[model samples]
Target: MLDWLRFGLGTLLMLGGLFVLVTAVLGQFRFRSALNRIHAAALVDTLGILLMLGGLILLAGWSVVSLKLVLVIAFLWLTSPVSSHLLGKLAVTLTDHPEREMQVDDPSLTRDVKEGD
Candidate 1:
């Protein structure tokens, strides 16, 4: 009975994580701006990954492998936000007039976009 419950719970968690990741992917494609895309990427890196790893840990039970999974999740929790912030900073630095850059079809920015600005 406990085994069945565990399996069901773990499966649900894994499925939820997959759903979150898919939503993140869709968000990335829907949002036209690079910064908006970063928001979607960050969701996958943090929440989606955490859910996936949590499900794996539950499926593995209280073993060394589970401990390692916990460690990995902890590491990701610690690093993901910092990495996202750095990437956002880099995007801001590299792009000129980011808000204006959001409008891809703007004729005035056509040359700038072609130049990879």
Candidate 2:
């Protein structure tokens, strides 16, 4: 029946999402630098949420809960990147030696900083 088919597909999606989420968490611990951790988390945040919620919506059918899930996914997709960018900027600004971690391919992009400026 249609119900059984929906259940199977929804479960598969949910499981896949759970796997991605767990991997991201482990990646955070595996990566040492702040920028690397942010990269790990931000990379999977949207994809994991989308997969899990998309599965839930499918199982819930055409209902109000499904609509809310869609909205939540949209909100997260918008915010996750902004937050990640801010965190990355903070890491770059605070680090005493940004050069070791970051590379600027263009010499024109940066200005020389005097020893006492």
Candidate 3:
């Protein structure tokens, strides 16, 4: 009974994770800007990974494997956002845009620059 429940839960989580992953991939192509792409990447970092972790935990049952799975999930959750942020920052720094050049005089960019300087 419990085994059946665990299997069912695991399967559901895996399916959900796959679905979110597919959406994230599609979003990368659908979004217009780098910022939008970053957001889509973040969805994969959080939702997709969480679902995968949940599925793994359910599949592994109560064991060291389950504990390790949780640890992996924790590590991913902790690092993915930071990594994504760094990538986004790098992308913004490396890319050139005429509109953004015009916005250099904008208050927000000026404030950000002053803060960094």
lDDT of each: 0.82, 0.83, 0.80
- Candidate 1 — what's its lDDT? 0.82
TM-score on alpha carbons, each prediction: 0.81, 0.85, 0.80
Q: Write the per-residue lDDT of candidate 2 for residues 1-117, one digit (tens) a residue.
A: 999999999999999999999989998999888877888999998899999999999899989999999999999999988999888777755666656665756533233321223
Considering only N, C-alpha and C atoms within 3 Å, which residue pairs clash in candidate 2? Answer: none
lDDT of 1 by residue, 1-117 (tens): 998899889989999999999998999899887777988888676888888999998899999999999999999999988898778767766776776856545655544553653
> Per-residue lDDT tens digits of candidate 3, residues 39-112?
78786759898998899899988899989988988899899999888776665565555246333446676456
Most accurate candidate by TM-score:
2
In model 1, the runs with Cα more than 4 Å from the true position are: 101-117
What overall lDDT, based on C-alpha atoms, would model 2 receive against the true structure? Answer: 0.83
Best by lDDT: 2
Minimal lDDT window, size 10, model 1: 108-117
Clashing pairs in 3: none
* Model 2 misplaced regions, further than 4 Å: 102-117
Candidate number that wins on lDDT, 1 or 2: 2
Error of 3 at 43 (Å): 2.7
Query: In model 3, which regions exceed 4 Å deviation?
Result: 98-117
